[model samples]
Target chain A: MALSTSSAITLNINGEKHTLPVDHRTTLLDALREHLDLTGTKKGCDQGQCGACTVLIDGRRAVSCLQLAIASEGRVITTIEGVADGERLHPVQQAFLDLDGYQCGYCTPGQICSAIAMIEEHAAGWPSAATADVRPEAGAPPLTADEIRERMSGNLCRCGAYVSIVQAVAQAAEAEAAQTPTTARQFSGPSGPGDLAHPAGTTDAEMTA
Target chain B: MREFGYQRVFDVPGAVARLGADPDARYLGGGTNLVDLMKAGVERPALLIDVRELPLDGIETTDDGGLRIGATVTNSDLAAHPEVRRRYPALAQAVLAGASGQLRNMATVGGNLLQRTRCGYFADLAKPCNKRVPGSGCPAIEGEHHNHAILGASEHCVAIHPSDMGVALAAFDAVISYETADGPGELPLAEFYLPVGDTPHLETALPSGALITGVTLPPTPVAAVSRYRKVRERASYAFAIGSIAAALDVQDGVVREVRLALGAVASRPWRAQEAERVLTGGPASADAFAAAADAELAAAKTLPHNGYKVTLMRNLVVAMLTELTEEAAR
Candidate 1:
């Protein structure tokens, strides 16, 4: 028998606070789908092999199934359900639809989440091995097919939507770079699954600062 | 699914305290390797010590003109560091050739170095593997051994270390630093991994209750000319068939100095001492390179199903050294 928890962890999910008594070993994917009923993030492989359980923590995409629920306490988590603004889908989602990036919708949520994070990472001047030049000051190189493949290598799709997924990410990168102002772009800390949280004993205001 | 324990420490002292409290504790960093193994039922530790919150996440230049990469530094951050790519191209290349962007973002330096072997028999508990269970006979000896080691093989174990970063670090004379119950110290890369002589289960030479703190690589002029060549079944996300990390200094077509190491063909990162000896006083040519490869691989003992790895290692050595030679000439 699994032990029940009396202490509840408060998580900021999609801009709302959720307090639930979750098992220590229960994964974030289980917490979201089974506990909170947020089921947009699919679980293809309980292990980290498949990218179907992808979600954005803060702003970076991470494999939710591999992460423990308690490990993500007090962090901002954005699921596929909260990726859009009201009725409009995220830019990556729109790009995926425009490019037919998915044959089966089972992997679409993961693809969109991963693509969104991929573009944000590239725009921040992070370089993958396939990035012809890894210099950060090189400044917005064209997202070629090889570069896209290398950056998106972690997120696998059984449907082989790689070509279209690459296209969607490229389109999203172009659109996102154009929409955001220069001064507003910077990579904050712990954007992925179980990223570093503010140290204990620090007040909420101090953590926000 | 089985239930286990999880504990997250806030600082280095806190982590050490947690480990000190428990004798049989597993350190969790990034959860890229440890968590996977636990889920697969290969590893079941009663206590898990989270070291991600420790103050070891940094990549900086040492006072001695070397690089000190902290244990918690992410693989992606280490590879993407400007000084790393500029000075040690092979290290960057090897890291990039690993799993993928998302994995690199999570895998840490210490975790990658301490990862266990990836033999089919080792992962499958049903199969007999001395590495997984000491004194158990190796089924891979007569079974399907396509991905097993060819160079270093005992009568008991044939698994290969599945880490590209460790191979590259071996080539550059990197040193591993760890803290034990008696305090902290460092050891050369070559002396870190123990051979699978009588006990295939014991992989590293670290004493009980020791934690890897950081890896330091001394500055070398030959670092700027280094390169990593990996020949895998696929273009990405696969283990190497036979990988070579070569660093050479060639001036006017003559070899000045060279360091070479092999992967996927040995129990540990096989440093090509004989190959380095053969290249010391000669011009960079196919003949000299082939002779060097032959000298290093001459003592290789292939298993029943892995004789092809001999040819793979020979070809990789020649091709990698030749490529480094050409680059140095330019």
Candidate 2:
């Protein structure tokens, strides 16, 4: 009912700089959805109890609903919309699509963003409650099913899509592991039976050569 | 939410000055709890001084083998720090046991200590909560109070402090460092919180415009044998119904020393000083643990719906002490 003072601030969202005027009481979630039209991040509960408004600030996952827009100045903001490489979907997104990780899809955006950061955190050897050894031997901690479930406990699925969601994360982790060789043997030689085996379209002479 | 002035301070002195100028203004940390309260209409600050970027985000060890944690250090960073996990495992476990991963990444140590009670009546603006409005009356004393306090509660209010970090700090005898308009000072974590007497609104002993710089945790001999056990309704991402943070020291199968603190069952993190007294120089066994728990919880008064917390707190204390003794054996 009363006129509120607004402040002009610049936000770096998804690699682009946008300067806009936002109310002093506006949250990062409201600023992204209402002002900037980045509606990919959904708002289930305005309170910090729900994880539907999760986003990445400086590559770390945080609930945007509780973060004031003015307080988030100078930090790189990454929402669900900025997760992909242009047209190509991120590996986690692709896995979610292939594994049917959503039903009504209301919490999909937050889940995807959280999963991306979750994988990176695990790769950096961050320990979760399920981890028995808080300080494990060097390198990435194994993405066990319990560990994934515990790490992803913040994001909730009302449609009971948790099974599919965990499956998607596990598959994406496998894909990422295969892409990046962690051990020396993977780069030295092919130890598996499928290595050096010719494809169906390859000729015998081509295979031999 | 109402419109308020926002000011970002880059130094401690500037923050203290801005807050001192306006009595109605409040310091903004990570905004995890303050913003939520603002949205619920429970907190209406005329001005918010942002102190998240005041260059207090480091965790370093003191010369005496203790840890000096900056105020703005994120919960996730503090829990994931190698020294914290190694030296004060109970503190790290307590931080991780609270909230979710997303919330932890945004919450700060200073804000966590200063967090208000999570009672439903306190958050409901329409309800008659004395904590929100003085002389309004505490509806939780007679209403749905399954999570209300069971210890150190006066007739005015019975809300519990909803912070796992405070419990761990109480067990470690941590000290809080702060800067005021006059000068900088420190207080023991136990003495920082004021008892909920007639005025539940005045939660802390902090003066107006006092900026919390950091907390210093003194090194303890039972660091490796300490543990935090939380009993909640759900498995993860839920508030504790009752919790315990304990550090046990055993010698020759006898209890040499012990420190205990309880959470979610008291107005503040109830330091079990009586329990520690009972455990010292006693045999390290289940019977001794039960006796200690009984001594600590002898003064607890429970509401209708929160009577279960007494049993829950006693069991948690015994279980945690037993686990620590077993760990020491190994």
Candidate 3:
């Protein structure tokens, strides 16, 4: 049988399931913006180079412009529109708002989403290019301005609002750390083992087949 | 982007068979590079075999005490792996030095190794690029080519492979494992990337319709003290203008063993065997490091704009090796 070019796939976005028929060529960014009217996820370069289309997929930051709509099924996706807890703004967003983290605000959504995940990744002890020591025992590096700049390098602001962006991210990271001392826990992979696409008990033969 | 079919498989052998049955199919890992190219009209596959769900996202130890990383392992996970950071610090640092946090979260190790060059001519359909078009001629050789290759490049193409992970892998003597219709096969990382003689379009030695399963790093004691240094236009989120991945083992003021690899200097991650040959069993001095670097660049040929790369590469090799030597001493 010839394969169909379109399929009715279900995408779990923002803790909600949306079933729709999408063309195979449609990227997840397009599906969210054009198909589902979730335009909070902006498209800057329409490529992976710019992180304007950044979203949290399986609790990690990823550019949606490069993800195929059909291939992203069965994954939990969170966009900027769903970032708030009903009326409460996320600490990252609140910091950005209070600090004027953006000028034009075109890249703010992406920056916000990216910062949320970036803080988690930093707290998890994942080293960045700015990291001096990569030894696992060295523990998580301090969340300084340089660290925030390196971790959030993907998002570009035409307004050159990087100064305030860095400040906002640093404040947010500090707030999060203060809330939970365990936030800077030693880097274990992702919290839940089941979050990864690969399940445990996979055979070696299959892994290296 | 053009329309294509998507097939996600949980098994490696079945995925290989599905791709083998279709001549124009391409296995999709993270889609960071492939999808971007498809949108740019560079790659137009009829079918995209989604291998992300395959049981190949593992990082395990081999019986020989080496590290084996599954092909579908994301760059973020790979860099964060405790074993990778402690045993092969250069590999972890290389991945972190690559693209941004979002791209790293989406890019797979296999896809990162197979990404095409970032030459403007290759992506611009209006321009002539030998790597994109077999005989279109390399415009980057004359046009804006400050980042072009200086070593192991022909008139056909001057584009450099823009992979930081591949550079570290080359230094550690990585071996690629793939599954084909015929069965399983292994190719050393040295032989994986084909030389850009006349066919810059033909990149890898992997057989047509074969699926890369994983990459294995042979146990190299020197890698434990290795480092990856990249010099780019910016402090972050930029491709390397010149980079080095060097691992050193120094004992009693003598170089016991060393591994050197250069990135953004050639069509592939250049394993600097000449430098290794010169440094092994030699006095562990900064001058010795410079001499080994010079020996490695003896065969380097440069274009008008890319002439700076030769000197840049020499400095990188020296800086990386000298730093690794000191770190090893510490």
Candidate 4:
């Protein structure tokens, strides 16, 4: 069904189309947790200062708390609840679990989602300011402790799980690179890199299949 | 307390229109800077006009070999642009040195330019601040002026402009474009900001109901050899205690044209014009650099809590200019 702007906006949350009426001031974080009951995305500061509310929009990691519901209309969103399959966790999620990447786990959802997006960003040859050289060779540059800290500076764990969280992101990036083909994960938008487009909500049956 | 209004505009005209229509409205760019202030109760705008969707996100080269940067351009984009990185390394370096990756992704150039004073009293509305509430009196002047201004300070207020990008742009002789309810006008970056000369509340010279459209850079030969040096309490995500953005054009070991500016030491982006005058036609030497920096700091009025800024800023200015001159020699 075609979605109108003024009426209830449809969101492609974790590949499922969820339509709900929302005020223009409502944040994506508030909408997910308060409206749809997708509480996996935590709200740390609710002002975008903390990355505890991080999620992926169109495959790039973004702070959901800062985004207005009207602005996120028809965008492809991936949250913590959608990261794992029916019974299996994503390799990053499993690695975080194995490495004890978090304590208290309040910031785990954001960390995991941000880590997944970070891996994709590095794979696409996007270099961080700390990236030693703009262009590393075809082989993946091992995410050193320093590189991990710099890349994940946005995600703060009051519980001090940084050392292990960095380890988990690095481990996941390395493991994921060894499995998925580079072409399979590249993000293609409506036109190009920063273009914005409204995608008609996909049916629930097609998404789940 | 939780109730607020949000409106997204598609163009600069729309944003200005909304803002003019309601005096209680505030323009929201990336929301990295303003949202934090709102949550902290530092800001209380009744309406938020979202300018993120505005068609002002381009970074392009202007005619006559200069650069024109849109106000809504992200900090990350400004830092990573090849032209900006290669030509204006100091600006690129300063932008990269500020905030973290996530913040850089979400901070807009306009909001960065318009960022309020980072005074502790100003941030906490509970405390008294001349900037936050004019005539409320400044507590930092006698309390903890460690992070306060040492240069261009008035008896009324001495809060500093806490933007790394602004300092670099001032040294590079950039210009700010503004579109108001009437029309458009452009002002050199150095003149865009007003000092705390009694009226501490009035910051930028942007006309009432005017929106910053973009910032323009005048291409300078010194840009290739420029560098930004910043010293802070921490390695990242902290405001600079002392920072220098220096660009030098040297010919045969003699300084020809030098543009120098100091950050975190003054009420505005403190351009060291006197320093530049002294450095011009002088050989690039430690003695020359030190004398020039000293000349600029001579006018600085340091309070008891901020006397350290005089020495730190002096040393920083000398070091930054020295390093840029050395880079040109290389």
Please provide TM-scores, in order, for all candidate models, with all chains considered together.
Answer: 0.91, 0.93, 0.95, 0.86
In model 3, which residue pairs have backbone atoms overlapping below 3 Å? none
Q: TM-score (chain B) for model 1?
A: 0.97
Taking the tens digit of each residue's C-alpha lDDT, what string does model 2 give over A122-205?
A: 655566776665532322346766777878889999998988888888778767756754432121110122221111122223
Report the lDDT tens digits of candidate 3 across residue range B167-191: 9999999999999989999999999
For model 4, give the interface RMSD: 6.1
lDDT (CA) per prediction: 0.79, 0.85, 0.89, 0.79
Candidate 2 residue runs with Cα over 4 Å from true position: A1-4, A135-141, A181-209
Clash pairs, candidate 2, are none
Measured with C-alpha atoms, the lDDT of residue A96 in candidate 4 is 96
Calculate DockQ per candidate and list them.
0.23, 0.32, 0.49, 0.18
Once fitted onto the true fold, the runs of candidate 4 whose alpha carbons sit more than 4 angstroms away are A1-12, A21-25, A85-88, A120-144, A176-209
State the displacement of the C-alpha of residue A100, model 1, in Å, after optimal TM-score superposition: 0.6
**Candidate 2: residue B169 Cα off by (Å):** 0.7
Which residue pairs in model 4 clash with each other?
none
Report the C-alpha displacement of residue B233, candidate 1, in angstroms.
1.8
Q: How many residue pairs clash in each candidate?
A: 0, 0, 0, 0
Which of the numbered candidates is closest to the native, going by highest DockQ?
A: 3
How big a share of the true inter-chain contacts is recovered in candidate 1? 0.27
Please tell me how candidate 4 rates in CAPRI terms: incorrect
Residue lDDT tens for model 1, B231-294: 8887777788888889999888788899998888878888899899989979799999999999
Regions more than 4 Å wrong, model 1: A1-7, A132-141, A181-184, A188-209
> Which 10 residues in a row give candidate 2 chain B its minimum summed lDDT?
B78-87
Which candidate, 1 or 4, would have the higher DockQ against the true structure?
Answer: 1
Lowest summed lDDT across 10 adjacent residues in model 4 chain A is found at A190-199
